[model samples]
Structure formats: C-alpha cells, structure tokens
Target: MFLVTDPPEPPATDAFVLEPLRPDLIDLDTEAYLTSPDVIREHSCGRWPVVGFGREDNLPLVIRHWSDHQARRAFTYLFLDPEGTSSLGCLYVQPLFPYLESMGADAQTLLRYAGGATARVSYWLRQDSGPELAASVAERVDEWLRTSWPLDSYLYRATPEEEFTVSSLDRLPLDRVVIDLPAEPHSYLWWSAQVRGGTTRMVS
Candidate 1:
C-alpha cells in the first residue's frame, strides 16, 4: 500500500488549477460531467456517467472522496479554469495495488517495468476544452508529476489521444486488459462487453 505522511499540495499552472473535489463544488462538477461527451467520460472514468447524473447523484461520491482524502487512502482533484469558476476535468492518484487486484493481474508481472512506482495517476480534460488546451494541460501535468510529487515513478494511464510509449524513467505505460462479465443479454453491460470483444454470460 502507498503511504505518505504528508501528501504534496495540488499543482497549478497558468492554464488551470487543481483543487480537491468537495461538496460545495458539486454543481460545477455535475455540469462538467454532463457536458463531457460519452467517449471522454468512459475513457477517463472507465465507465459511462449514468443518464441523468446530477448534483444529487454526485454527492455521495464527493463525500466518499473527501473521506478517502482525509485518510490518505486516495486523492481526487478537480481541474478548474484559471479563475476557478468552472470545473474543467478531474485527476485521480492512488496506489497500484488495488488496481492490479481489480484486474486480477499478478503484481510482480505488472510492476516489472514500473521502476519502483507505487502510485497510478490518471486524468482527463473536458472534450470542449479543444485540442490545444488539452495538450497544454497534459504537458503541464506531466511536468508537475515529475517535479512536485515525492514519488519518483508512476503508472500513467492516458486517454486515447494522449497515449504514447513511455521512454522516460518517471512514467510507466499501463497495459490494457479485457475483463469478462456476467450480464443479462441485451443489457448495457453486455453490449459494452461485446463492443470491447470481451465475453459476457447471460444472467438468468
């Protein structure tokens, strides 16, 4: 497990700022989620933002994140515009153990190329932010992770547009895996599994 006695503060740049996700920002968070395209949401979050996901739907998640942050178990940050008036996206930083566990992959095998990295970092930008701004954000975050954080290495999961082979010592490439699930035939999960070429069993 990753443990930090004092987690570093969120990073900021001229293009955007990172702040811990909190209750008061639920409205902005909801708006960000609602405005983001389905593809972007799935790429960033690993699942679709369910239909009609609003402030009410986001409250419990924010609360859970707050608790996790306080416990130093994980960290979730909201990307905000320069003036901090709007949510642009989100960042997630957490230990790699849980991720490997969920994937049912051998830790030793996956960490072979991790270069002693203990944490996994992932982020996404608002689709409407435009390619130029998205590129800037990704570049800035990459620098911040290398310079500001205490960890020397990290497993970086990037969106399709940002994905690249990692040749650097500070970052490691994340290998993708397909998982099979049991879902009722014709259900959304079953459809998703089919599209991803994953096997899904019909639920009685």
Candidate 2:
C-alpha cells in the first residue's frame, strides 16, 4: 500500500500488485516463499526454519514479523496477482546495518552511512515467470521505492559471476562499486543513477 508518486509503466502482467502481508496471509506467503527445502534455500540464502517446526509455529512468527514491518522495523511485500488471490513472489527491503553486520563487517563499516539513506534490497520470484517478469518486477518496485522511501542510494547484493544475476541487476541500472568484505559471499553493487522526482538517469 505504498503511495507511488509516479508509477513506472505497467508490467506485461499488469494484474500483479505488491501487498503487505498479514496473519491471515501467512499460509499464502509460506506456500509461495517457503514451500519446500529447495525453495527456502534458493530464496533465503540456504537458511530455513528450525527442524520439526510446523506451520502452527510458523504462523505466529509470521504474524509477529508483520507487526515488526508495520512498526517500521523491517519491510516485506508479496507480489500478488491482479485478483490478489495468489502470491507470485516476495521482496525484502531493509536498512544496510543489519546486512553489513550479518556479513561480519567491522563496527565502522556497519556504522558508516554513505551519501543519504542506503536501503538494502532483494527479491525472489518464481523461475517459471521467466527473466522478463523478473526484470519487470525489479524495475517497477525499485521505482516505487525510490519515490516512496527516504533513500538516496541502493545496495544490491548478488553473485555477479552468474550470468543470470548480472542480467537481472542490469535492469535496475545497478553498477558495481569496489569494496572488500572478506566474510561476504557475494558481490555488492550500488545504483549509480540518481532517482529524483520519478525519473532515473546516470549520475556523473
């Protein structure tokens, strides 16, 4: 339910919309984002819930997480079809501190704020959707974020060595920025374009 000032051109499937998750929506979210071990691993960097935990335990956690999102602690969204009945994908948007800390960066690295607010962003969509939809979702959501959030720069992490990832990130106009984080497993790229008043263009 973000207030998009200037929405980007609609995706090929314009029926999709981004919606915030709630307790009642837990089953749908779980089914779409955490259906199986392989699905969880692919989307969550190989981290899954504790062993023996069932949906009963998972539901309450999702409720609490949604509460945190409402409190601005963290943000997560579900990409829903036009009918708003099914989830097509998931997106996570959070500040850079937790990400850096999780990567085992030093305190200074975690504390440093470059430029304006830096938001760490990532997404996971169904492979059946094909590359076009993936790129479309990223672009549309990236534009919405730039307009709706207090962000001046975006930090995107992916294994650039992978051809698919490189193509996906290029859709967002994110270019590689040099940095070293021995503990991190992937390359981090920063968007080198300026997003102002709904338009994005190369800076410098």
Candidate 3:
C-alpha cells in the first residue's frame, strides 16, 4: 500500500481561497469544469470535465476525491473566488509513488525519483478567467509548494513549456490516452474497450 504524509494547511494566496473539495461543492465544481475551455480539458488528460460532461458524471468523481482525502491517499482542493461563493479552479496533490506507478514508470525509476519527491502537483483555472489569472495562480502555487509544503521536491505537471521535470527521465506524453477514451459517458467499460481495441490517433 502507498503511504503519504498528512496534508498541509491550504496555502494563503492573494488571488483566491483554497478549500478542500467536498461533496457539497459538487455543483460549483461541476459547473467550473464543464465550462472549462478545450485547452484546459486537454491538459487534464481527459480527467477534467469534457464535452457532454454532466452532474451525474461529476458526483462519483467528487465522492471518490472526498474518500481519498479522508484516507490520505490523495488530496483535492477547489480554488474559490475571494467571496468563497464559487470555484475558480481545482488543485490535486497525489503521492509520487502511486502516480509514477500509474504512469507505468519502472521500479528503478520510482526508486530513484520517489525517494526525494513527496507529491505530484497539478492545477487548472476556469477558462473565462483568462491567461493572466492562470499565470498568477501558477506562480503562487509554485511558491507555496516550494516554501510552505514540506518536501524536498515535487513534480509540477503543466504544459510542455511550463512543466518542471524532476529528472532526466522524459515526461510521458498523455495525448494518446486522452484520445482513446470517448468524449461522452466517460466510464470503465468504454475505457476498457478502447484499451483492448488498441486503436489510437493523434489529437491534432
């Protein structure tokens, strides 16, 4: 089993508030993701709400996030507007070991990299917020993770230009995986079918 450190206090940011993603905030979170631009959705490896995303699709995912946070397996937080009335984006902090394993990294690579890094961090902003807000949030998050979080190193998943690789190992591209899954009704059966079919095409 993968073990992880207890979560740190939500970082204080000048631009927004960070709160644990809970079931009650489902509606706000769902709306934020469903309306996110295709660029944001593509960067999320199709895990974020895609075309045809709905409340029903978000419910279980939110519940799982809540469960995982309670179990300390992973943590998800919503970035709320200053008034705390709605979500602007989301943050995910996941244990490095499991993340690497999921990405099919071999044991040697895991042993070499996971020893120093504690978590893999990623985040996204609402498309309407514009690129300036996104850049600000990214800067603030990087500072928080480097200064406040108790870790020697962490992986920040971003676009190719923004991604900070922790080692010489090339970061795995996720486009094919994202392309294989159907845009609607993101479910296990469809995912399994796509994997077994071994059909893939470039996204561009």
What overall lDDT, based on C-alpha atoms, would model 1 receive against the true structure? 0.60
Please write out the lDDT profile of model 1 over residues 13-43, one tens digit for every residue: 8888899888888887778877876635455
Cα lDDT of model 3 by residue, 1-204, tens digit:
334465668865667888889999999998888777565544555555486778898899999999989887788999998888878988987766565566565555566445434566667677677655665666666666656666545555554432222111122222222212222232211000011123333221
Overall lDDT per candidate, in order of appearance = 0.60, 0.59, 0.61
Task: List clashing residue pairs in candidate 1.
Answer: none
The TM-scores, one per candidate, come to 0.72, 0.72, 0.70
The residue ranges of model 3 lying beyond 4 angstroms of the native Cα positions read: 1-3, 47-49, 106-108, 161-204
Model 2: lDDT equals 0.59
Q: What is the C-alpha RMSD of each candidate to the true structure, in Å?
A: 9.7, 5.5, 10.6
- lDDT score for candidate 3 against the true structure: 0.61
Candidate 2 at 17: error in angstroms?
0.6
Error of 1 at 26 (Å): 1.1
Least accurate 10 contiguous residues by lDDT in model 2: 1-10
lDDT over C-alpha atoms for residue 49 of model 1: 66
Better structure of 2 and 3 per TM-score: 2
Which of the predicted structures, 2 or 3, would earn the higher lDDT when compared with the native? 3
lDDT of 2 by residue, 6-39 (tens): 2233233583687776787777776665444444
Ranking by lDDT: 3, 1, 2
